[model samples]
Target: MSKPSKSNLKYKICSLLSLFFMLFFLFPSFIHADTSLQGYKEVFQDSPIIPFLNKKESSKENNKEQYQRLEDVKVVPGGQSIGVQLETKGVLVVGHHQVKVSEGAKSPGEAAKINVGDTIVEINGQKINHMTDIKPIVDNSGKENKKLQIKLKRGDKMIETSLQPIFDKKEKAYKIGLYIRDTAAGIGTMTFYDPKSGRYGALGHVISDMDTKKPIDIKQGSIIHSSVTAIEKGDNGLPGEKQASFQTQEKRIGNITKNTDYGIFGILEKEVNHEKYEEAFPVALSHEVKEGPAKILTVVDGEKIEEFDIEIISSVPQKSASTKGMVIQITDPRLLELTGGIVQGMSGSPIIQNGKIIGAVTHVFVNDPTSGYGVHIEWMLEDAGIIKPESNQNAA
Candidate 1:
């Protein structure tokens, strides 16, 4: 080819230089992210994150916070659902002794008569007190078309049922498509307890499937000792998340009583470290929380009590008509740097107004961490079995 002229060559060089600058400035924003994420740097600081290779820290803490064990969860008089993703295989019980079933098949996952709350008592004449005892019978039945008879406890009555086997292509063997869980796991904190009645509540929301995002069947959501791995603070623009390792501990911390927008309720099987408990942080009256300054007691940032400044943006006595009665404006910087502001896993944090706990931070407006939802303590207290739903009733 003939030699290119100087003018043409310079033009080509300028064009290439312009293209390089454009790519350097704009490609990152246009590049599709392999993962959907929310985090914060400084304002106007647009640095890209290089994926870190280190594994997150383990979640268990040998030192528990000094907490006050209340007799009952004070009544906010509100309520909430259940899908919990389970890893280890176990006899799947839906609620309070309900076992789930599939449409057809005679094996582990089959049987139409079995309802969600029926408790599986025995499998193939073997006592199925726990999951380990139940899975093999179900698995073997699927593989060989073996007839597996399952004896279960429904309410108080004992019933025996058999499931036929079928092949499941997903497992490359005979299968019944039944999800199983001995219990669910998550990173949640206790909100309050009632000393008068021995009722307590924690994790101010329903535990659900991370994937399907559906509430786990209540029967399936018995608590387990969850290991919280990492924690981020709640902040103005970003939200916080408690990364935890799911672990199963049979030590019953408590029994679930109810669930609502205020959170879930459970009664302690026995008193937790009573000495470790300090007095409960009282919730504030809606009428008390105002448009000035307030603080939040949060477990974000590794279970430490980090306080933040926020404005009671607007007080809607019944905004959700479910839980939080007031709205807030998160105006803290440190919290914003950690959690954009009320992110997942931050639900149930007590919003202290005038030194009294008024509400639990329930949700962060997706686009705005500075603004989010709060459930009134009164409703939470009622749902947690702290008091009778109609406590202020006239004597009959």
Candidate 2:
């Protein structure tokens, strides 16, 4: 009955095109919002998505809360030389060996898909504690002509596999073609101990396997009192070390629970005493540490916690956890003369400034014997479970 006029037809067509474009652009925004909401639910509440959505706002709020909590944290700085003995959760596979049989050369460990960094915790149904523990099992499996069941830990996952042992005619023994170690022992200075919780931290770095250079998966460990016998004074291009002796089996002063990049954490079985420093001191956050005069508490001699002057050459006010939070230089004439600055065993020596424990010595500069790096006491405490940071207090 009615045909639209040309002008009206044009207007109607233009209106439809406008509506189409509007929905096309707006649809994506709606979908994106919904997808983000779903993702948020799938992630933990404390996930980084919240900050990504509003970094500036979230960061301000987080920093405020963190600084507030920092005011409430109190810890005692440690400066005692200690002996460390760590037993891995399982036998750590350090390297592989080639077994020579009548047929040819082969490695059973390699054939079983085992890697160097794997920790062998069990053989068959028996728990493996030492390298010796595997010998009998391997011999029996070889004699019985059965595949040996192996349980190992790779990262956070537990893996199981089976491998046939090869008989070595020369040695008259079965070989798994793997080099393993179950225990590690060393000496380090104690960084700090919490008088309240008995928790302590030391070695301001991970206890890594010397061969694989991987952090040890600790089953259990202990710390004992050690006495420094001598020091190989460091010089330019070479790092010095502290010669120490201790009775590892005599008595355990503490129990180790964790080995982290920041340090080793544990609970002290008894109150640790430092000869010159018996009283506990307050700890300072990374931000509170300043570039100026400071001191370090470390034992260079028999059972004595001596305070040596040092300079906080430069301080990094870490917004997050880091190993190198401060640059330190040895200023005490006695320390410099005795140890030629920070030595290997001097790591974890408590750095004190303004009567507060600010950080701990972590590393020595190879080219500069008198200078080294220090980690903030705050990060050490966090690693020790003495204080928990609320947000991105520091990044690795």
List model 1 lDDT by residue over 238-262, tens digit each. Answer: 6666765543445444556454456
lDDT of 2: 0.83
Highest TM-score, which number? 2
Lowest lDDT 10-mer window, candidate 1? 76-85
lDDT of each: 0.53, 0.83
- Measured over all alpha carbons after superposition, the RMSD of each candidate to the real structure, in angstroms, is 23.5, 12.5
Q: Candidate 1: lDDT over CA atoms?
A: 0.53
Regions of model 1 farther than 4 Å from truth: 1-134, 139-164, 167-173, 195-198, 219-229, 232-239, 244-257, 269-277, 280-291, 318-321, 392-396
Return the lDDT, model 2, position 56: 30
Tens-digit lDDT track for model 2 on 1-396?
899999999999999999999999999999998887655554533442122223234333433422224555566678888999999987999999999988889999999999999999899999988878899899899999999999999989999999999989988889999998998988998988766556789989889998888999898998998988988999999999998898976867888889998889987766776566666777777778889999888988877888889999999888777889889999999989998898899989988899888888999999998999998887777777766665326421
